[model samples]
Structure formats: C-alpha cells, structure tokens
Target: MRKLIVTEFISVDGIAEVERLPGVTWNDEMQRFKEDELADSGAMLLGRTTYEIFAGSWPKETGDFADRFNALPKYVASTSLKALDWKPAELLKAHCRKRSGN
Candidate 1:
C-alpha cells in the first residue's frame, strides 16, 4: 500500500500557519523537514491551500528542495478546483478508514 505524508511549516511556538512563519531563521530546517517527510512517501496528501502554495513556488525554483517536491505525486483534497496546471498531481478520490471492529 502507498502512504500519504503531510509536512507542514510551523512557528517556534508550534503553529503550522504559513502566515505565522517569517524570516529565514528556519529555512534550512524546514527544507530538511520537508525532505525527510517525503523520503519514504510514495505520495503526498494535502489540502488545496498547501498545494497552491507549493506549486506556485517550488516548481519555479532550482534546488534539492524543488527537486524532491516536484517529483513526488501529490493527492490534493478539494472539490472546488476545476483543474491543476501542475504535473505530478491529481485530485484525491478516497481515503482509508480505521475500523474499531477489527
């Protein structure tokens, strides 16, 4: 089975809001963390906001961070998006659920 990894940027206070993180202090660490999250992931699970932010910036950049991010298959969760202009991405269809009866 494939796995979905979610990597997020957070503040020193542990907030994952992009607007909350500023400056270049954690740039290296964030890139490293992103790489690590994608290391074993066959694909990624993301919300539309995350996808837009990533697709808008990473694909235009040249670096290790861009390489890994551009390569991974992304499954974005949304219904409003008509289509994606980016490669290596698609709409999420279904998700596995955990059962208590098992």
Candidate 2:
C-alpha cells in the first residue's frame, strides 16, 4: 500500500490561501525541506489553483526546484479545466475521488 501525505502551506493565522501575501518567501530551511520531501515522493497531487500556479510558472523557471516539480507526475483535481497541457500531468474528473492505501 502507498502512503498519501498531504503537504500544505498556511499563514500564521491559519490562512491557506497566500497567493497575495507580500514578503512571504520560503527560507533556506523550508526550501531544503521541500526539496527533500519532493525527492521522496513519486507523484504530486494538486488542487486546481495550485496546479495552475505551478503550471504557469514552473515551466519557465530553471533550478532544482523547478526541475523536480516539472519532472514529477502530477494529478490535478479540477472540474472546470478542459485540459491539462502540462507534460506528465493528468486531469481528474469531477466524480473522481483520490484514494490511498492501494
């Protein structure tokens, strides 16, 4: 069985949506942690917002983080997206449910 680990970033006030938070950046420790975590994961599961954010930016960026992010297989849960053009990406239908322990 495979383990499903959900990783997220939230503000100190418990706000999960931080796309507009200014001066917010991942420190060295956080970067290292993220790199290590991604290294261990074979696939990435993302919501539509996050998937779009990454899909728009990571493709044009160059670095270890970008390389790892673009290289990993991604499964995105979205109801409105017509297509996922990001290479190695799959679009999950609205009725689909993410499962673990398979």
Best candidate per TM-score, number?
2
Candidate 2 per-residue lDDT over residues 1-102, each given as its tens digit:
768888877778888765654467859998789888888899988888889888887799898878877998998888778899777988887756657799
* Candidate 1 C-alpha lDDT tens digits along 1-102: 655444555657776777655553656776677677767667667777888887787789887766876887777877666677667888763442334787
Candidates in order, TM-scores: namely 0.70, 0.82
Whole-model lDDT values for every prediction: 0.70, 0.82
Looking at model 2, residue 30 earns an lDDT score of 86
Number of the predicted model whose lDDT against the real structure is largest: 2
User: Least lDDT summed over 10 consecutive residues: which range in candidate 2?
Assistant: 17-26
